[model samples]
Target: MRIDSHHHFIDYSEAEYPWIDDNHAAIRRSFFPEELKSVLDTHNMDGSVVVQARESLQETKWLIQLADQNDWIKGVVGWVDLCADDIEQQLQELVQLSPKFKGVRHVLQGESDDRFMLREDFRRGISKLAPLGLTYDILIFEKHLPYAIELVKQFPTTAFVIDHIAKPVIKEQSFAKWNEDIRKIAEYPNVCCKVSGMVTEAHWGQWKAADFAPYLEAVYAAFGADRLMFGSDWPVCTLSGTYSEVYQLVDTFIAQLPAEDQSKIMGETCVKFYGL
Candidate 1:
């Protein structure tokens, strides 16, 4: 199955997404399943893993409901208060509701500059997830790489996918320090990278497939096709271009690689990583 491993959704009536409210000019409106289905069909995507954008249990349940209603949503990476005292109990309740709830995400990208990831309670809570057969999505910037690497070392068995290639700002063409940190993270066998969120990082209106090739190529070189996966980061990628445009960019790049390597990076890696 061809799975787009990362995508976001919102239901205005179900719950309020405070983050998008501030200043995400292009995506202030609702992003419904119908629109997502159109994109999926256009790109021949069999299904997708609907990821969490808000930090609300209601949003998580809402995504599960969408998955039930839409066959295109093969899986979901929902969110919950990882630091909640009853996190383990909460995950048990969710797993009973739907087997499609494949993993959990904490939007650490929005964390304060302080030691959020290294906190005692957060570490305790994260340690509880792996035994429940749940994976954690790391949505963080380069600064959080040290903490992420530490987490991987602490939980060597926990499966973690690095979302959006660490949200690199490729438009600025900045990579001196970030590249070193990324190389360190790539050393972990259990960690994987999602080749998503590139268009938004590039010169938004002037982005081309070529602009992203170098970055994607670097990831392929560092992690190899077995560990890299293509993700549309839809709604978010819409900020730079259409779903077809983004997919075609990745398609062209992968076409340049060997067929087996192409298959691994384009879809197969996602299947193996997410256990789809």
Candidate 2:
């Protein structure tokens, strides 16, 4: 079954999503599964993994509810306060509601401290995830790549996927450092990467598919098809291009691979990673 490994369903509310600054007008409204399914259906995508857009247990439960209601939603990568002392209990509470709860993520890119993941309380939370059969999604920007490498190295047995390919600074043509860092992290078999969110990092409306070539080539070289997965980063993708446009760039880029390799990057790898 084909899957868009990462995307978010947002019930837009100003208070809940203060991060929706003026530049992000397109995604300020709600984006639900019914509408997403309509788009995915046209692409012959069988299902998707709904990721956390907001960090709230209530939102996590709500996402699980959405998954339970929609058979087309294959899994969920929701958020939990990994730093909280009762994190395991909180995960159990969500699991009690449904096994659709597949993994956890922190907007690690949003954290000011580069090594925030190594903090005592946060490490305590991360230690609880894999033991419960859950994966962790490393969400960060270029500066956090080293910390992410450090984070994944220590958790070698836990399954992890770097979100947005570490949100590389494509706008500035930032490459050499990111290229080297991505290759270093991929040295660990426990880590995979989502080839999503590149458009917004580019020159937005003016981005050409060719602009992604070098960056995509770097990641594909680092992770290869077996450890890479496709993610639309949707609604947010609307900031630069339509869902079709975003999906097309990645789909077209990976089209060069062998059919079996393409199959793993498009869907199968995620199924095995999250055990969906």
Q: How high is the CA lDDT of each candidate model?
A: 0.83, 0.90
What would the per-residue lDDT of candidate 2 be over residues 36-148, giving only the tens digit for each residue? 99999999998999999898888998899999999989899999999997888998888788988999998887888888988989988888888889999999898888988
User: For model 2, what is the error of residue 28's alpha carbon versus the real structure, in angstroms, after optimal superposition?
Assistant: 1.1
Report the error of model 1 at residue 50, Å.
0.3
Off by over 4 Å in 2: none
The lDDT of model 1 is 0.83
Q: Give lDDT tens digits, candidate 1, residues 88-123.
A: 899999988898888999888788853576777788
Worst 10 residues of 1 by lDDT: 13-22
Give the range of the ten consecutive residues with the poorest summed lDDT in model 2. 148-157
